[model samples]
Target: MQIKLIAVGKTDDSSLKELISTYSKRLSHYCNFSFEIIPDLKKTKNMDESTQKGKEGELILKHVNTSDILMLLDEKGKSFTSEEFSEEIQKKLNTGMKQLIFVIGGPYGFSPEVYQRANQKIALSKMTFSHQMVRLFFTEQLYRAFTILKNEPYHHR
Candidate 1:
């Protein structure tokens, strides 16, 4: 199965970009991994939080295929240990899924419509993290998960 991470807004920090790139390159050895950025909305000076999210939601949905499994990185979602996460990844791969898409929403979070489209949700931590940081953290964890699956030295048990 292919894995894709879709996040809103551009990551401006060069350091973070480099780190994310590093993990992404490592991930390519195990599976087809993609990081897609939905550009931040412009002309939102008068738009409310809900309205902004709704617009972002529309764009987020556009990339999804009916057969793809959509997972949201949400604050209220279930949190799993690193080993458990690797197991979950294995389960998905076993299903022969075409694509497994995980979305990182904008500052205001996901819209009602986006939530409706999601197949499930997973939380990284109980503490809050910036959208940009989440991208880096998620990428690294995904890389680690693959390493664990392959019994590689990259990940220590």
Candidate 2:
């Protein structure tokens, strides 16, 4: 299955971008992986939070295909251990999923429409993290999950 990570905005920190790139490359060895950045909305100071989210949601939805299984990285979503995450990925592969899209929404979060279209939601941690930081964390976790699946000593019991 192909795994795509769609996130809003660009990463400004060179250090974080480098780290994200590193993990993304490692992840590619295990699957058809891609990380896409949807440019942040311009002149958002004038727009209300809801409107900004709605606009961003449109862009987010545009990237999604009906056949793709959409998973949102939401704070209130299900949390899993490394092993469980690997199992979840295995289940998707077993079911013959074509594309798995995990989205990280904009500053104010996802709109109602986006929520409705999502097949599942996953939470990386209870602690709050910057959207840009989350990109690195998720990619690293994905790489780790793949290593764990192959019993490569990347994850512990």
Candidate 3:
């Protein structure tokens, strides 16, 4: 199955971008992988947080498809260990789903509509993280999950 990661806004730190790219490349070997970035909304100074979140949610939803499974990366979502995460990936793979889409919303977080549409919600940790930083963290974890599934040494038990 193809796995796609969709994150809001660009990464300003070149180092983080490079690292995210590195893990994304490693993911290509195990599955059809792609990373997508939704540009940040412009001129948000006048808008309220809810409005900005709504606009960002629209852009995020535009990349999704009715047939695709949408997973939101949110703080209040399910938390799993490395081994358990691999099992989640295995469970998704077994479904024969065409694609599994994961989204990292903007700073204001996801809108109510977005949350309603999501099939699953997952959290990397209880601690808060910047949206840009989450991209790299999530990508590496994804790569690590694949390695664990393959019985590779990348993930030590």
Candidate 4:
């Protein structure tokens, strides 16, 4: 299955961008992987939180397809161990999924419409993280999960 990671906005920090690129390259060795960045909204200073979220949500939805298995990276979503996440990925592959899209929303999180469209939600941790930082973290975790699936030494029990 093809795995696509969609995140809102760009990563301005050079270090974070480098790390994300590193992990993304590492992840490519195991499966078909791609990272997409949606441009940040303009003139958000005058908009309310919900309105900003709504606009970001619209951009997020535009990248997704009806046939894609959409998963949102939400704080209140289900958390899984490294091995368990690998198993979950294996299950999706076994089920013959065509595309798996995991989205990281904007600072205020996803809107109600985005939530309704998601097939599942996954939480990386209980603590909050910057949207840009989450991209790096998620990419590394994805690389680790694939290593675990391959029984490689990259992941330890």
Best model number under lDDT: 1
Candidate 2 local lDDT, 1-157, one digit each (tens) = 9999999999999999999999999998999999999999999989999999999999999999999999999999999998899888888878787999999999999999999999999999999999999999999888888998899987763
Question: Candidate 4 — which residues are off by over 4 angstroms?
Answer: none
Clashing pairs in 1: none
Question: CA lDDT of 16 in candidate 2?
Answer: 98
Q: Candidate 3, which segments miss by more than 4 Å at Cα?
A: none
120, model 2: CA deviation in Å?
Answer: 0.5
Tens digits of per-residue lDDT for model 1, 1-157 = 8899999999999999999999999999999999999999999999999999999999999999999999999999989998888998999899898999999999999999989999989999999999999999999999999998998987774
> Which lDDT values do the candidates have, in the order given?
0.95, 0.93, 0.94, 0.93
Backbone clashes in model 4: 0
Error of 2 at 87 (Å): 0.7
RMSD of 1: 0.9
The deviation in Å at residue 11 for candidate 1 is 0.5
Candidate 1 ranges with C-alpha deviation above 4 Å: none
Scored against the true structure, residue 150 in model 3 reaches a CA lDDT of 98
**Candidate 3 backbone overlaps, count:** 0
